[model samples]
Target: MSGVTLSNVVKKYGETQVIHGVELTVDPGEFCVFVGPSGCGKSTLLRMIAGLEETSAGEIRIGTRDVTRLDPAQRGVAMVFQTYALYPHMSVAENMGFGLKMNGHPKAEIREKVAKASSILHLDDYLHRKPKALSGGQRQRVAIGRAIVRGPEVFLFDEPLSNLDAELRVEMRVEIARLHREIGATMIYVTHDQVEAMTLADKIVVLRGGRVEQVGAPLDLYREPDNLFVAGFIGSPAMNLLPAHPTEGGIHVPALGPEVIACRPPGHVSELVAGFRPQSLRIGAGDTHSVEMTEALGGVSFIHCARDGQPKLVIETKGNHVERPGTDISVHVDPDEMFLFDKLTGHRLR
Candidate 1:
């Protein structure tokens, strides 16, 4: 397995720059995910690494070899795209071994490699079937198997599971995770879904507007975000950010109650933003807020509360309890669970 390194990597289209100077390293056998909102340049960066897009400035190295100017074929990287991109007329075995065949490998070698890949992806029984005969998930496995036969130093997946249904997507996530463990190859995956990034990545690169906001382990980014962007983007329902004012000993949060939350703020800061995850809050007694909606999903429920001018707050609770719309309620927040940020710059106040 070989690691991938990027130093001051940049991309541009004529006079407009899409990918800023990005510096990242994917350790050998690491599953690194690039996650962000749409049009955030996550796909652009992945294409640059795969040699599909030219780097305007900087260097890209796979292990020790600088692949900045190398062709995709020469970079020793295989990419699996959102679409299966399979030949309808060709059998699964043929699709898997096509790259090697075109490169002039012997028939025996091609068949051997295809068989091995098929076994690994559990596509051995479907080798004789054409792309049209297989299901979406099986076709995706064929696409993945094609990459495996090449034995590339790095595997690049650009939203490979986007085309699948919800059930298939979950199943394929497990398959991809298992494949990574069994092959132990350096893989770079790009997705806009934070849930996918959180579950699949060993390291996640969060990007926005062509710039990296943070890079760290999944839980690390979730528990300790660097700024407001990360704090809001990394979570499912997102962290609740309420407008606040700095007080003598703590911060005054109007959304929670009239009382000041017991948390220290920087002396220089005046305006503050307080963050609270839905799970950190609970429904208490009193009618300070009104329930806007309630989403009861089997074992858990999310209650959306609203006030006159305050930001909406989502309170996550256990069980199938549902609150009626316009029902008066009070939200209780623990001072220790609050995350303070500077309202002006959107930076965490720590």
Candidate 2:
């Protein structure tokens, strides 16, 4: 019942509009992530939902209650920012219980809530340590613990993992996932990292230019992107987009030579863009295409190559490959894996 709903939400700053009529819904206990490149307004939308930012138009509802004009404290939501924002002068336990203490809760009650949150975050041993004494990951956990003590109906995370090191980011991703499962609170997270969005979200809202590009489950968006933008943006290393033209049999990709990458396209589209993921492409031994580079990341290697000096196409290869730079290779285009889009419009051609 604590799910969030937004109806044609809009935000403007002195006539400069940002969020434009965004309609979204997050089910209770669901983990929703807002993901996009920078300046896409993902963080602005999260702030609007948290009641920290005012809506220029439309309404926001949380658990059947309209909170469009309510104060942030009035909305049953807790937010954890990218920064820990913990008190360096106080112990971990003290920092966690500060909000409750301000709300005039009894000392015994505050201690109990802090203890429960600490146990959940595995901060029991470090409860007496100050913020300066903890690692980045531990400090982030303490920030999360502070939110947990409030028992908010919804949790807002604005790129909470961005501040951590690569290893710590991975570790915290697991921890956040576990926290969602354990607490089962409705959570909305915003991040620019597609990997984090794919791993943490039950549903992802992909935003662009202050508008929603697409919203769906991670694999759903991956397998069937609505446009060239979604296809190119959602995956790691990104999907390969090459200029092509529609022909009688299929789309002719100059990069792959005369043989067209087979795909059924709606009529009226002549020029098109052919899309393929790195994993979907296979390279054969040939000199027609030269290997530009190979990224060896254990067990799998991403082979980057170009056809006739065109845009580089990435092909994923499993196991050990002896292919070195300047090695000539040929691509085996899987017709079934091909995605076609309108060249000019960038819209997917069904």
Best by lDDT: 1
Q: Lowest summed lDDT over 10 consecutive residues: which window, candidate 1?
A: 257-266
Model 1: residue 13 alpha-carbon error in angstroms: 1.0
Compared with the true structure, all predictions reach lDDT values of 0.94, 0.92
Model 1: CA > 4 A from native: none
How well does each candidate superpose onto the true structure, as a TM-score? 0.99, 0.98
lDDT, candidate 2, 7-91, per-residue tens: 9999999989999999998999999999999999999999999988989999999999999999999999999999999989999
How does residue 160 of candidate 1 score in lDDT?
99
Across 124-223, the per-residue lDDT of candidate 1 in tens digits comes to 8999999999999999999999999999999999999999999999999999999999999999999999999999999999999999999999999999
Model 2 local distance difference test score:
0.92
Positional deviation of residue 286's Cα in model 1 after best superposition, in angstroms: 0.6
